[model samples]
Target: MSSSTSTSTSTSTDDETSSPARRRSPLRALFGRGSLDIQSTLLVMLLAVSFLAAIVIGSVGYVNGRDSLRAAAFDQVTSIRESRARDVERTLAGVQQAVVLDSRNDSALQASLDFNAGFAALDEQSIDPARQQAVTAYYEDTFVPRLDEATGSSTDPSLLEPTSPAQAYLQSLYTVPFDDDFDASLAFDAADDGSAWSQARSDHHDYFREMVDQLGYEDVLLLDLDGDVVYSAFSGVDLGTNVEDGPYSRTPLADVWATALESNTVDSSFTTDFEPYAPSLGVPTAWIASPVGSGADVSGVLAVQVPTETIDSVMTGDEGWADQGLGRTGEAYLAGPDETMRSTSRELIEHPDTFAADVVDHGTPTDVAQRQVATGSSVLLQPVATTAVEAALQGRTATTVNTDYLGHEVLAAYAPIDVEGLNWVVVAKVDTAEAFAPVDVFTRNLLLSTAAIIVVVSLLSLLLAQVFVRPVRRLQHAVNRVSGGEIGVEVPVKGHDEFSELGGAFNDMSRSLKVKQDLIDEQRRENDRLLRTLMPEAMAKRYKEGEETIAEDHTDVAVVYADVAGFDDFSRGMRSGERLALLDGLWRSFDEAAERLGVEKVRSSQQGYLASCGLTVPRIDNARRVVDFTLELEGILERFNATNSSRVALRAGIDTGQVTSGLVGRTSMVYDMWGDAVTLAHRVQDVSSQAGIYATERVVQKIGDGVPAVDSGTVTTQSGEQRVFRLERPAA
Candidate 1:
């Protein structure tokens, strides 16, 4: 009994010794521990001084330095812009002065004016009968057809009053194959480029080239008031082009001429901002134009070119931007009315090897940069779309921290350049990183000085490590899967903390990216399908390749035209959605049949559906294919009638022959076919309300062996009688 009592008493004493009172409290465990604790406390004090003190000092320094740096950058670029603007003004003003002197003293412009006066005085009665007949024939054959093609429709000759100024002016603007103006311009240009046959023209050409070289110009051009480039120091390539009619009219140089001609005085001159001159292989070019004569005696324009290098130099300052006050990442550049950069960047010129990488980071077309870099070309084609540029272009001077064209965050200062006949913005910018380099340095120093506090941090980190490590590891694995394009993964969410929230975010992001990827794929497929439907795949490719005129010849294409016979009256009784739905269903059925039959359905509308065979890719049995498809179309109509209580009727015409096909409109493209085959088909469809189906003679000849048709005789119309056959059901 004594031994048992003694054991119990000993156990109670041991329990009291190991109680909560025996252990150190949380606070004393940290602040009251021995040697390691003293070192930790001292480190914590140093960290407070380093980090907290640094924050107090750096914030004030950052704010002040940022404002000053932005202001200085803005001031520097604005000054450069002003200097460049003055240089452009002076250069263009010189061209004007020279042209005025030529108008008052030279014979070339006077002779040109006399020629124009003589030409304008002649009317239909004053000209020779043969010549007048030739003009009328030319107008009827060439001008009328071109006008119809341009407007995408034909008009009655009676509706056009030839005597009207607008009509006469438009006619005069036409470039007759070898007109006198084109011929003269070609001759002068050939002489200048040393290709002239005539000795006198050759001497004149040499003089022009030498004069251009002597004046530090790229080219010297003389243009008649009618907008024909008469003489060129370069070559005959652009000499024959009339500014009012040819493709060159789309360029900014043409706009400069229009501006110059707005007034009839020698003092009237204009300059254009930097743009791609198409005739010169789309290089950045600027032009200045002035009239050849003063007052009513004005005849033509004398234009001079200033190399973009000269402008670049002014923007960057003398001696390669060293005096421009921009640090490693700061640059001053010019943006024209088109929002395209006009001046070469400083860093690009200096670091040609890294051009591609730098521009890629800025979100530029890296291929263009790589190509330019390979050839040691300047980076003058980048656009600047920041708020500073926007405000500056709109005639407001502003400074802000924003994103620049290269997609870099920058402190930007921008202002509009004060120059006549131009809308240009000047932007000065420095990278946010470089601009805050001092603050970054201060932050690094503070972190380095507080390094002794690592012992305490390590201890705390060890305690939390088990709590964070698992979720973070799972998140890292999930991220790797997502990066590898396996976006269906989900990180397991744990207890609610920042790490758990991070896992939730990761899952949400995975879902979002998957949805986005799906949408992008769908959009790409839709775009490709839409483009192919709007035009032939070949033509669509050409259009995407930047071809302005997309037309092709198909010698044996079969064309079809089909329309709802009584759609207008039928639709009058139906709601808009119902009417549209009917058309949609009808076209969808037609599309299905087309796919089944291998016929190309190019267009469809409320009015009709137009399709072709052998239009893009050649098919030897296209005629037969089209015939079979139309036969199936009739069966489809019968089936549709069986399904719907209200009856819908259709009329169709088919023909096979040579046709010319092309696209129209810049915004919404339309593919159209034209020729006797297409015309006859459309005409047959239009007149056949009760006939149901008509096939022209061409179709019967090319419909191969199995297709069925009956002789339908001739149908008369605007294009004269077209012999056709009626498409009839075969005897089963």
Candidate 2:
């Protein structure tokens, strides 16, 4: 309709002024006859019409396209932002439920009672001075370096050691001996240490570790009524120390512990925002605590370290930005009330150098970015000083275009996360450069086309208005479609005139637009492929298909925890190259044995090896198979010892029970397993001082005479006493 009206208007004006006298009369009336020739009059009339049409059409097209792109960008981010906000709230709610439930459970009550008794018992007796010094040395020599690595701070080792004698004694048993293997500290509940506190920990520690593993918590702590950290699942430097006033007296844990103490009801829970936790080596840590009692008179506090990875996974969409409909530069993150990030930054993972440079450009200190990169986290590190963060923190919800933390202009959707006891905001943003790229291309092409139309109309008007008007109208209509986001719209070419050339250029532009769109689609596909490269094809597919949390519970599985005895001493006398080679060869042999015996290797570090059967693939004889796998490991290490002329021996533990396995991280996905089976295996392995294969009663029953075994002493655990057996080589 617009095209017909425009063409008719042009035709009527041309017809009325076709005669030179008529045209010259208007020109003379407008400006004197000698001021403009007939040809000049025609040229001016044509230029006015073409310029008006171009300006009106170009203005409408640009505004429409810009608004469309803006709306789409806002919608994309808003959807993701809302989803992330919901997930965050749901996650926190789950944590709250876990805290409240665990706090009221019999296990927590028993643990508090047992631990308090054990703590009081220790306080009554004097600890060995040498053992207390060893605990102090462990913090100074071992814990401080690990803390320094995570927080990028030179903390005083002297200030970190516990002051209380009982705290020192507990640390000596749990953390001091496992200085080389920090993660092992939590698992070695049955440390073969003759201490009543050790027995208390062995009895109840598995419950906490299993909870942490199942729920993906960083740690779980039990504080007595007097504010002593009587039990810690990870057995960090915090255990046995009083949170009311201790070495970590001023930390977030203390603050939360105080909050829990004030809560009048058992169901009452408190959550603290992420802060640098001293015990976790200054790693960004948040806590959720509830009173552990049946009524208003609280017995103690039960706190769980909030797993930041779970938050990061939800916020970052497992680092699958494109999968979350966020283009390459788009990301979702949490901003605490402090205006610092509470989740991982997408740029910090994809391009750390770029993240550092951009953040530095945006008024962040160079050292801050360096620390963020060093720690491989943005939580409580990256400052988000954007308008969106400000508004969201103030409880406002909206989507707008503004400068991001990195100073990039972004379309951001911001809202406060509606989690109780948390003052956090969720912001999903994408750079405008990426979001409005199509609109930008449209704008540039529209301007150039309008300019070309005006120039071509000037010359063509003098020839014949009617002769070229139709072609110009055709080009204008095609431009209208292209401006409305109709890529690949082509104008039909007639003769090889200048108008035809214009038509050809339009076709080329349309084709270019199509190609760019295809490239963007291809890039998204490439991103999916990249995710596949990081994990198994099945898991990647499941993740791509939008399963937010991938986890499985296997009813029957065998887990093995193996560590090479005398490795530290053996490697101490060798060069770095030889040391690494020996470790590599040992691990390689373990892996090869696992593969041959159909046992899946979960993970292996220099400190220990973990493998499982009936986890990935179910097997009825999983326990027997894992026992065989450990026996094979013994043979491999024997051969390895002969080859290297070393005296290293294998100390392994095996158990069969239910286990849960899942992917744990976002940027670096890890397939890991946890449950009673894994816990018992680790505990049993650490219970014996001898270098041999140990199996729990469950494994012993499953293998039934298949592998020769002798009775290993029973270890008291959370589940009464568990009989352990030592596997012996066949009498060949």
Candidate 3:
């Protein structure tokens, strides 16, 4: 470990004899023995010791910090997803209410029922001539044109006579133009004949058309009690066709019709899960079918087409997702009971072709991402296979880590939606790569920072060794003269480092062997002040009066850890100067509690404070004192909030066990303690949720006999059970 020169000195020190004064302040003790041998060896030892210790501390810190940051990230992501799912459910519920109100107020339904009753009263077969003409006109103009645009069909749909229900649906494939009012479109050439049949067809078509435009439906249909499409606003080709015998017999709409027929009350309605509606060029769609009735007699069903874009807007905010905090790859979407996505993806919405193309190029054809992209429907109708969706579809709420539809690892939250008549699930997720990106950056930056610190320390160690050793060479010359009985000679001490101080000490020793007897009284008083700094009063007195080493073995010592939370988010938001100012002020307040309680304050770091009681000064109430100190921290934090307008709180952990206590690190004089007890105290801090003072069973066993400790119960993990308690600060 030592450099070439340091190795040679070590060999020389092994050969030469060491003297007594050179043994006192170890560095001066080593050099005063006629050798650079020990000084060079000590230089290497100090560098190696500090550098290795720093590497160890840095590694442990980086690992713990990385884990904590990852935990915070997951919590943030879960919250974002839950909020989005609630929003989606709330928006859909409102829309469902709108449909129910509109269906109840649809005037065309009453008029159609009135006309049907009148026509049935006619013994001979009767049909509305004006209604027939309007149907033909609607086919020739709107239906034929929009169909041609949607499917690129040049054939005029009106030219084909409407002999079948399929043909009838094709003729009414387009909605009414926004310019035409429903009242005007439905107003037939009615005379004083008092027959409503004249505009029965016009009334049905015009009212449904107006509803689609006003309520933003893609299409609307009126199906009778027998599952027959009696009228259609956009895709009216299915009129007069029973769903079981119609061209769209196999679709989800037909299945929902059985439920729709039964929902005859004004408030009752049926909402179907998505399926390809053959009537609408075989595109994916969902419909809310409200009952069209006269009291208890169900006349028909008013099926309003839910535009996929409405749900898309709910998932992908109309403005953008800046407020959602889902990052680049996060998205919210709905999944039907059939497990297919029922809303458009943000990826597909942004770059429609890219997702499909990427999935194809990657060759994972069976993947959900590929399937959704390939569906080509306005609302995605692709099946997904994942734990979150599966659990959500089963009506369970879940937040988990899983491989997403795209085969990318994601942190996902899914919840079953309980809309009036739809079975759907909301899934909100983000690619783990984007979500935990800071962890990677943090690790790299930590390594770079540690490397820089090591390099600087290495360089400073070498530089200081040379600087300190320069004066020691002069002291070596002066020590030789003093040893040879040349008492007048002095070692010029010119610096503040170890060697200069050693040289000064030697100069003092050689000049004052005659005066050393006179200065003994002064040194004893200085020792008294130092003892007070190092330990409690009783121990300090023993140490000063002549205890060689101050140490104790305690059967029960209560170790406590108190930390301020949200510091990462806090420090990141503030300027460097401001951050240090805040921490300095906060710690100053934190230290006061330990100072007043006679609890030995050990050390403080970014992880926060460490303290212990009943070691230096023996006491039976170590746990009691530790809990009291923690409660003081709560008050300090409470005051900190009142003054700073901040909600930042302290989180603490307490444990009772045996530990060795002593003054360690000889040169610097550090009074420190350690054991399994210390580690558990820190571990408890991690397990706690907030600024809650938690104590372990060991602390409880000792404190419970006297103090009122509320058992907080145990945190059972796969690893083991950790029993803890919360101090309900025993009724004063």
lDDT values, one for every candidate: 0.63, 0.82, 0.65
Instruction: Write the residue-wise lDDT of candidate 2 on 283-365 in tens digits.
Output: 88889999998877677899999867879988887788998799888999999988999999999999987889999999889
Worst 10 residues of 3 by lDDT: 1-10
lDDT of 2: 0.82
Best by TM-score: 2
The order of the candidates by lDDT, greatest first, is 2, 3, 1
TM-score of each: 0.40, 0.55, 0.52
Clashes of each: 3, 0, 9
Clashes of 3: 9
| Ten residues in sequence with the least summed lDDT for candidate 1 | 1-10
Instruction: Report the candidate with higher TM-score, 1 versus 2.
Output: 2
Runs of candidate 2 exceeding 4 Å displacement: 1-54, 145-154, 194-196, 444-732
Instruction: Please give the distance, in angstroms, between residue 69's alpha carbon in candidate 2 and its true position after superposition.
Output: 1.7
Quantify how close model 3 is to the true structure by its C-alpha RMSD in Å.
45.0
Lowest lDDT sum, 10 consecutive residues, model 2, at 1-10
Extract clashing residue pairs from model 2. none
Model 3 alpha-carbon miss at residue 653, Å: 99
